[model samples]
Target: MTAADRSARLRGLIAPGLAALVCLAILVGLGVWQLARKGEKEALIARIIERSHAEPPAAPPPFADWDPKADEFRRVRAGGILLHDRETLVHGLAPGEPGRALQGYYVLTPLRREDGTTILINRGFVPTELKDPQSRAAGQVGGETSVTGMLRGSEVRTMFVPESDPARDAWFTREIPAIAAARGLTNVAPYLIEADATPNPGGWPRGGQLRVDLPNNHLQYAFTWFGIAACLVGVFSVFAWRRLHDPMEPGAA
Candidate 1:
């Protein structure tokens, strides 16, 4: 081809070529990010499993010594009087099996320690019908009680999730501060006790609320991003090759 013809062909590719380059960079970057996420997710899952299975301390650590990040999911034993009068229900969805989800609400009740400190215990799941405290009266044991469970931080609600309505006693997430304030509790622990699966008095509020099921599909996500990047490269390569072989009008895209 003549020099002018070659230059025209190269110029014809400028718009589409720059577009493909930008897309390719984004896709490859996403792939790398997902791979890094996979490693971080794996480490987090390991730490959570270890904490969940470890032997608990005699009693929960002092409130002043609490650390949200380092102390989450730590198993501990806490003794206090069950304040059944002040209970909050956080909506929950437990998987009964593959493709089956059992909808319920987690019963959270404040436990009053001898030292006048309070901590909320996620006493666990109860079907919608038994949401009312009177419906599950037997499980609402009064007086002092000891509970073994893992410590957890407050659950955050996303922008898409609805805000907790204290007036109606409706909560979408396990928000500690909101619940404590709504229930008029004082000196409450910063963290919550996710009770272990020890059967309750009437078996209404089941314990063992360990919901640490982190999905590790980052590898698959990385592959998908990389695959799209590869396909883009292949398509651009073929288009550029064809464009280079064929004649193009001057300044055409």
Candidate 2:
């Protein structure tokens, strides 16, 4: 094989080889980004877990004193009568561990605290078959009952979705303010109550099934990206080798 032929083949490989290298670098960069995101997610999960297990804090002043950033997820203890007639059923939630095709609803009612503030309470998830609001008869707690739970800010409405129809007893999202207005509630707390796992009467709206899990698969995603980068490098290497050696055959020369 002539040296000139070999030189020509080497020159032809340079452009494609460089392009492949650039692609490999891009894939590697993406993989690194995903890894960093995974680390961030893990840290966030740790914080949430810590918050969930911490003891409940004292109740803040009122909705007027609520500061979402500083007070979100803050635990508090309060007591009031559950307004059973005004209970709002949040639709689209499924029942049981497997969350199969069975439909269900989240029982939400206003708790009129002693301080004259109304706080929405998510009693618990109930099956759709028990849609009769009266199925769970209103049992008075008699006097003020002490309730402990997490403080969550108001639920926001998503864009492009129709507003919930309370008259029809249908709800898709948890827009607290809207729900409060529909129930003719005044001075409603800025947050809702996620009841603690406590024993309640009749076992209705069984409290304590709040699953606060955050998905953090950033590490796996990062590895996948890195694997793609490695594949890119291998493909480029093969292409480069073929270009450099194919023309070196004696017959071809």
Candidate 3:
């Protein structure tokens, strides 16, 4: 091709070429980020699994020494009395199998420890019908009792989740501060204890339903981003090839 024709073709490609370069860089960056997330998720899952299977400490650590990040998921024993009057039901959906989900609410009750400190205990799942304390009075263990459970941190609600209604005693998450305040509890711990699979007297509020099922789809996300980037490269290459091969416009050169 003549010099003028070649120059015109180069000018036509400048914007698209620049755009392709910038887009490719962004896509590659996203793919790299997803890969980093994958590694982080794997490590977190390993630590959680290890804590779940380890032997529980003889008793829960002192309230002064409590740290959610360091202490979460640690199995612990606590001797206390169940304050069933202040129980809260948090909305939840537990998986029954691979795809089936069982709609229910987790029963959270404050346990009054021997030292007078209180900690919220997620006694576990109960059907909607049994959510009312009166409906399951037989299961409520009054007076002093000892509980073995998994320590857990406060749960943050999802973006679209509705806020808890204290007036109606409806909760969407295990918000420690809110529940403690609403229940008029004092000297409450920042963390909660998910009671082990210990059966209640009436077999209503089943315990030991804790599941640490973290979604590890970061690898898939990384692949998707990488695949898009590859497709973009192929498309840009084909466009460049076509432009180069197309006959130059009729002109006096």
The estimated TM-scores of all candidates read 0.90, 0.73, 0.88
Q: Could you tell me the TM-score of candidate 3?
A: 0.88
Candidate-wise lDDT, in order: 0.88, 0.74, 0.86
Candidate 2, 57-112: lDDT as tens digits: 76675646777666666667778877777888887454466746556777788888
Residue 223 C-alpha lDDT in model 1: 100
Candidate that beats the other on lDDT, 2 or 3, i.e. the better one: 3
lDDT for predicted candidate 1 compared with the true structure: 0.88
Best by TM-score: 1
Over the full model, what C-alpha lDDT does candidate 3 score relative to the true structure? 0.86
lDDT, candidate 3, 1-253, per-residue tens: 7878778887888999999999999999999999999998888788778987887775554466777767777888888899988888999876677888888899999998888889899998987777678888889997888888888888988899999998888899899999999999998988899998889989968888887788999999999999999999999998887776678543525
In candidate 1, the residue pairs with backbone N, CA or C atoms under 3 Å apart (3 or more residues apart, or in different chains) clash, namely 196-208
Model 3: runs farther than 4 Å from truth?
58-67, 97-99, 249-253
- What candidate 2 gets wrong by more than 4 Å, as runs, is 1-30, 62-71, 92-102, 138-143, 154-167, 212-214, 241-245, 248-253
